[model samples]
Target: MFFSFVLCCLCLSVYADTDAVKSVSVMEGDSVSLESNIPEIHQNYIIKWTFGHPENRIAQINKEAGIFETYNDVLDGRFRDRLKLDHQTGSLTITNTTGTDSGDYQITIIGGKKITYRFSVTVYAPLPVPIIIRDSSHCSSSSLSSSSSSSCSLLCSAVNVGHVTLSWYKGNSLLSSISVSDLSISLSLPLEVEHQDKNTYSCVINNPIRNQTTHLDFSQLCQPCAIRGCDSAEAVIRLVVTVLVGSAAAAAVAVLVYDIRIRKAELETIQTSHRPCTHCS
Candidate 1:
């Protein structure tokens, strides 16, 4: 009978350990509130709160003993001013969340036995206003021809953005994107030569917390003079000239060496003929 009792106790302990509640979610701005249903077995237990992925206990409340303990090192400063414990409900509230406040959190209960609960918190900041700047040098479409291509780039500026996504759009469709703490830049794309009369480009910056956009008209973009097959022809002509000059130089050097060798041979034959013949009678 004693053996059976020990077995049942062991089973109960295992079940209690697995019954701990855990919840995690992202909170907006600088505050977060969490609530969980407490089991009857946990009524007499002490609730402990912790931060980090594995849930290191940072603060605790002893319900029966009416005692509270906190670890300042584990709790972030931004959370320190805003962290509050509801002793009655065993819930946790955090305010004034900052970028550094994003992380995992946990709650542990200590009573006749020990039970643990865990949660994760994420904080977000709003997107900043986007600024549009014209890039005239790279914005020229007239520089492009049937045999040539031209590129144009535009600048988008913003500030104080946190975890926000930036994108470029032509109408409702996305074109390109670049992310920055304050702004989002767009990459240079091919501009239509005929579309220079139309204004149809914009920058879109967004985050879960906020969003902003900037627009560009055709006049703000670059327009270069169009030349028919000028770029390709110029490149081909330059290459051909380089090759021809190199070949001419080589031919000139070969001709000079050949002339020098022929002259040396002729002089040697003339000297030999001018020498007195030993067999002359």
Candidate 2:
């Protein structure tokens, strides 16, 4: 009978805990308000707002005294100068929240009936700018034209992003994407694609807070092919020029040789005619 009674009490405590807790999320360096639904405070009421545990009191209001207190010495470093209380509503506001401030909070009201309000807070830092890198370390500008296909691997990465999505886009089309709901972490996604002519791509990192994007131009990546085409055109032009120059030189040499032979023949005939005339006289 005693064991059964203890089990019932434990179950009731768990149920109450689940019912009292409310979830709240805020970004780092931002402010959040933990609401307490105490619309009216009696003259003899006492309101205490605590962080994490009831022992670590942050703020409290004594309706009888008509004054409020902000705890500094007990809180140590947290909520030192950024704590505010709305005396009318018993709401607690925290400014410049940090990751360490994420936890459970409680408000205990001592009035006609003792009532408590619980809050579960989460603080996240904004995601950093994502980076994109080519995965093929062996591929260089000089080797791009030598490869039969311009396809290569790429990686997009981001750090300290919580519950965020990372995606790769080929122009307006979504190619690949990854997401994590776990704690803030560094993550990366890989994609392989052919570096076709003048193709455009972009990488995007986004969450509920903010988004960042980086763009890629395929024309720049496949520049080696254009360079190779230019080199081939230059070789063809040089070959044609060499053939024309050699043909022109050969024709000039043939014309000069023919003229020299004709002159020599004419001179020989004149000499023979003059010698024969002398003999006859």
How many residue pairs clash in each candidate at the backbone level? 7, 0
Judge candidate 1 against the unseen true structure and give its global Cα lDDT, from 0 to 1.
0.60
Clashing pairs in 2: none
Our model 2 lands, by Cα RMSD against the true structure, at 19.4
lDDT tens string, model 2, 134-206?
A: 6644254455557633665678899877788999998889998999888768889987676654567889987
| Candidate 2 Cα outliers beyond 4 Å, as residue runs | 1-18, 53-55, 138-148, 160-163, 169-175, 180-184, 197-201, 219-281
Worst 10 residues of 2 by lDDT: 9-18
Clashing residue pairs in candidate 1 (N, C-alpha, C atoms within 3 angstroms): 30-97, 138-152, 139-222, 142-224, 158-182, 158-183, 159-182
- Provide TM-scores for the models: 0.52, 0.62
- What shift in Å separates residue 61 of candidate 1 from its native position after superposition? 2.1
